[model samples]
Target: MRIGELGNETGVDIETIRHYEKIGLLSVPPREPNGYRNYETSHLERLAFIRHCRALDMPLADVKRLLDFITHPEVDCGEINRLIDAHLHNIRERLHSMQSLEKQLEVLRARCGDSHIVRDCGILSELVAASHKTGVKKD
Candidate 1:
């Protein structure tokens, strides 16, 4: 099938498919006599695998490594396990950072409530003081 048909069948954007091809994630398929690219069943399966990996938030480099493993099924899965564990560690770090950000925002929000004019807005005052490096501690 043509590139458009392959994209439609795989639910991937044409540009992304082309990018994958350009980046060596997907192989370029043979073209017809009319010069139209003819994708095969293998392309469909590979694209589906890539889409699934992307849905899992796996980076392209990791996806490529996984693809390498797929190409060599005889390799032990220990490295794959290590890669997933590292990804989990990174996710945990981000979650901790996000939680800390939430707490900071909550503290900032508590600086002011309704019924105050802009001049007396405690939140804005705190922000301005912080921007100037006034060393004003949060209460």
Candidate 2:
């Protein structure tokens, strides 16, 4: 099938498929006489695996490592477990940081109290005060 057909089947963009091929994540398919890519079932399956990994927010390098493991069935999967654990740990840290940011935004949002005037906006006032405190000169 053509690249567009492959993308339609996988819900992936054509440019992204090309990017994956460029980065050696997705294998390049053979071209037909017309020079259009002739993707096979293997390409579809590999693309699907890559898409699933990306959906899980796995980094490309990690996805590549996972793909390498797929080609070697005899190896222990302990490395995969460790990789997933590390990703989970990173997610937890991000969640914690996001919660803290949410709290800060909540406090900042409270400063405005409701719709007033721009001059009476406590949020802007606090921001300006913060910039001054941090020695940030506004252009």
Location of the lowest summed lDDT over 10 successive residues in candidate 1: 129-138
Q: Write the residue-wise lDDT of candidate 1 on 39-105 in tens digits.
A: 9999999999999999888999999999999999998999999999988998899999999999988
Residue 130 miss distance in model 1 (angstroms): 2.2
- TM-scores for all candidates: the values are 0.86, 0.93
Candidate 2 has an lDDT of 0.95
Give the candidate number with the greatest TM-score.
2
| Cα error of candidate 2 at position 67, Å | 0.7
Off by over 4 Å in 2: 136-139
lDDT of 1 at 57: 86
Which pairs clash (backbone N, Cα, C closer than 3 Å) in model 1?
A: none
Stretches > 4 Å off in candidate 1: 134-139
